[model samples]
Target: MTSVSIAERLGQEKFLAQTYNRDFLHVPGAFADPGGLVSFNVLSDLIARHRLEPPRLRLTVDGETLPQHRYAVPVITRRNTRWDRVHPDELHQRLAKGASLVIDQIDHLHEPVGDLAASLEGWLRAGVQVNAYASWTSTEGFGVHWDDHDVIVVQIEGAKRWRIFGPTRSLPLHRDVVEPEPPPAEPVAELVLTAGDVLYLPRGWWHAVTADQGVHSLHLTCGISPPHTGARLVGWLADELLASDIFRTDLPIHAGPEAQAAFLSALRKEVIGALDDSGLLERYAAARDAECVGRLRPSLPYVQGVPADPELMVRLTTGRARLDIVMAEGETVTRLTGAGQQVDAAPAAGPILHRLLNVGWHRLGDLADTAGVSVADTAALVAELVGAQIATVRSEGR
Candidate 1:
């Protein structure tokens, strides 16, 4: 396997800690060879192979989404399944007439994009989703709009102009009590992004984009899901306080004023005690990571058990998996948790498990050698991980 890491290629740490979610960051020529990650050919192959239907693949022009029937036709498959098939000729006609294309959740269909999303999730400690947008005209696909989550955009091909109007509201939620006011008459900043350039925009930053730069445009936008808010934290605290009888008791809604006051006081005390811990947020994050539902993949040929083949490749499916060393009884144990499952193994297997997490793909023999164990033992450990839905195995050619 190639040892080149994406972190070094993207200068991920420098940009993430310094600017992520704080302000807009524009990096010129950050991805000098963006084609290596994705290209027009890749997008075409995905559309053709996946039988992508309307909405999942759609078109927009002048801030209005075009109807699905304009570019695709519904068909019934031999397997009795119904799906919409894109009419290539009609699709091209629409694009030529100034319509932009959009594909949602492209990361799930593309390997390189999936890896990119996983890398971001590992770095940001949050869920990430990638969407693709392509345009042929200067016409705006979506008008001045704001996203509920922060986005990292990469210009894969051509150039596009952006007009950014600073946020009118602070940290707005998708379901909020109040809506933000209209943007001001003038934009705060204007930028034109070309091939290999990168831009990061925080949530609620109103921005409008158009490909009026005399060239077509293709780009990928990776959306980073927000972390837990104070409201969510309090909800989790309520669950944690279930051990107290006061929390379980009926509300004193019909009782006297003194009785209701006592109930409120007791509830406040339990909440305060839970919030007093210095590590409350840390604990909540760890718990969320442990229970995260990662991408699901099947180890087809090895449905029963992983064979003791040295050439087999193995990798973890979840980006948020947690690995830790803990004392169990008198012996040290290695615990791996993710994808809603947990597994414990001997301390000696730590090296093998850690490699699976950090490395994209490793041969069974290489992992066995690193762990100083037999190939059969390594296969057994990997089988346990596969059973837990946190890891997958494939033949060498795949």
Candidate 2:
């Protein structure tokens, strides 16, 4: 990866104001040396190291996922557990014949790729999962399709052509009420993404891709979690209404129309009153953000507590982790919420939390020095977080 952070290189402010959730964006030469971010070697190592299933790794040809049996053979472990082990020779034959190789959740498999994903999550304040795609032939890996979530693409090597037809339906969902109509005869925009290029496409945009540049292609698709919507708000509201007796009451099954109308009338009133609250969306977003669990990882070898070593590195497990101010005992308190835990710390710890909320690792000593805290306090705080799996720590050498 370049010394430059991915968020800055993405021009976060400009993209949000002009392009986010509205249109597509293409930036050529985004990274002068994208190979450092991820290469073919990394993918090879990951496959060899992990017992990846079809969901984690698979091959596709023209939108259909090829059977694992085609590229792997079932192996019975000593415990008698069976799983298809990918055969390098068969896998190569399939890819050479025009099938596209894909590794889902590549971010979880590789640390650098995980860092790349965390940068986007920190900027967007949304979950991001990156999948790697590699193709050797001019085949349409997924045919023509649209995604339920927005995606940012990084062309790591070679090139791939994309035919963008825009959206036929507005913000389609994975379990949508209606599917999009057939795309038009021609694409609205057609372009090739070479190494170091970046592209962003909003959800529901129709597109087709092919690696027909007479060279193999390797790319990463970073899909952002879908934005909170009115539908989701209503779902949340349903749970919130449980405190009220009317919502908790049984539905008037087999009741007369007049009685049913009375129940609905009360329900409608409750719904309207909740919707009238102007901060409903804001409140819902905060709740969801607090509940988000990002990249849960263990801080091994420190099972008991984080040691008071100044050189130990630390980072939040989730990029979406957030810090906010709340009054406690008539004094200002810093409340952190992420990885499914809420921690209220002294206001003095705000700086330390802020540093950890960023996208990379940090030394415990550096966090203490920068936050104006003692190494002992820093170790204590990190120990608490590490115990909760809200953050992880490692030695600098590791």
Candidate 3:
């Protein structure tokens, strides 16, 4: 089966260089089959099976979040533990009253959405979290609110109308000292998105959504983490500057004005020098990608070690993993860095790791053939990756 690449769906380099983090993009029928990734049936199944509580699963109307008691009740389980499960009758009533349903971090619970988010992370070089929204009425769920992080919204089931008021503040932060002023009275643009439509809204763009176009709406909003800021760069630079004695020395708190001025000048020069490097942003982005704490999954049954089974399937868990080749003592060494862990292996294993990083899944035999090694040796290498929580193995295809 052919796989749908999210990067291609979003227009790849064109979207990244032009529309990403700069302006809103509306792509009609971009998903073609959004239901393949998620659907109303999937949301129903999740609600019926999982013990989801407020915030993780919420009902909101007119910008106010409804309490859990409005739709769910606590029931004593057979284990004598109290669990809050969705009361279908109450949930229906609540929806009838114009409350929108929300499932936070749906990517973690759904495989297709998880893969979509991982693909986005690989393309955008930033972490992503996908939230599912289902609305039945024209009532707005969030009113005119702006997210701190940029969002790529995929309309999965129905139609939703969005009134977008462009940002009044420049790159607002969650913990900013000043709050963004109220949005303008009139929206800059209004868009109606139906099934298979995709929308990208940058952070700080105030928008209100409603499912009033004679149809209910179900959509997945993929929240991309905000880009690195100047503040963050300065913090990282401070740590990087510790190598200099001037930065390590104590502050001239009780010294004369001349001493304080000299100290300030020296500090400014150090910071400016670091900022002058043309590769500063590139280096910072690499560090962030290398340290991404990606989703973790356990390779069950093979608790101790992976066996040399030809049918076993393996894949990397982290999408933002980095592979580097280094020549040490006239011999090539390959380094795999990601998910807060680093692994070094012989150059022969580079092909195998690169394949796992890019491909969704590979059979042990295929990986062994790619690396030109025995199945047993390949299994051992995969076991090391599994131990580091960077990769997982399963008997069934994912």
lDDT of 2 by residue, 1-398 (tens): 72235556667788788888899988888888888879999989888888899868999999999999999999999999998888999999999999999999998888888888877776776788999999999999899999999998999999999999999999888888998998898999998999999999999999999995658999999998766667878899999988888999999989999999999999999889988999988778777777778888888888888999999999998877878999988989998888889888888898999888877899999999987989999999989888777899999996
Per-candidate local distance difference test: 0.84, 0.88, 0.87
Candidate 1, overall lDDT? Answer: 0.84
Q: What is the TM-score of candidate 2?
A: 0.94
**TM-score order of candidates, best first?**
3, 1, 2
Q: What local lDDT score does residue 199 receive in model 3, on the 0 to 100 scale?
A: 90
Structural RMSD, model 3: 2.0
Best by TM-score: 3
Model 1, 1-398: lDDT tens per residue?
01024344445777667766667877777766787667899888888888776677889987798988898889998999988888889999999888999999887887677777777777667888889999988888898988889888888899989999978897677988889888888999999999888888888889999985658899999898864679767888788788999999999999999999999999999888889999999888887787766677899999989999999999888788889998878878999988889889998899999988773668999999999999999999999999999898899886
| CA lDDT, candidate 1, residue 192 | 95
- Residues 86-107, candidate 3: write the lDDT tens digits: 9999999999779999999998
Candidate 2: segments with Cα more than 4 A from true spot: 1-10, 252-263
* Runs in model 3 lying further than 4 Å from the true structure: 1-4, 327-330
Candidate scoring better on TM-score of 2 and 3:
3
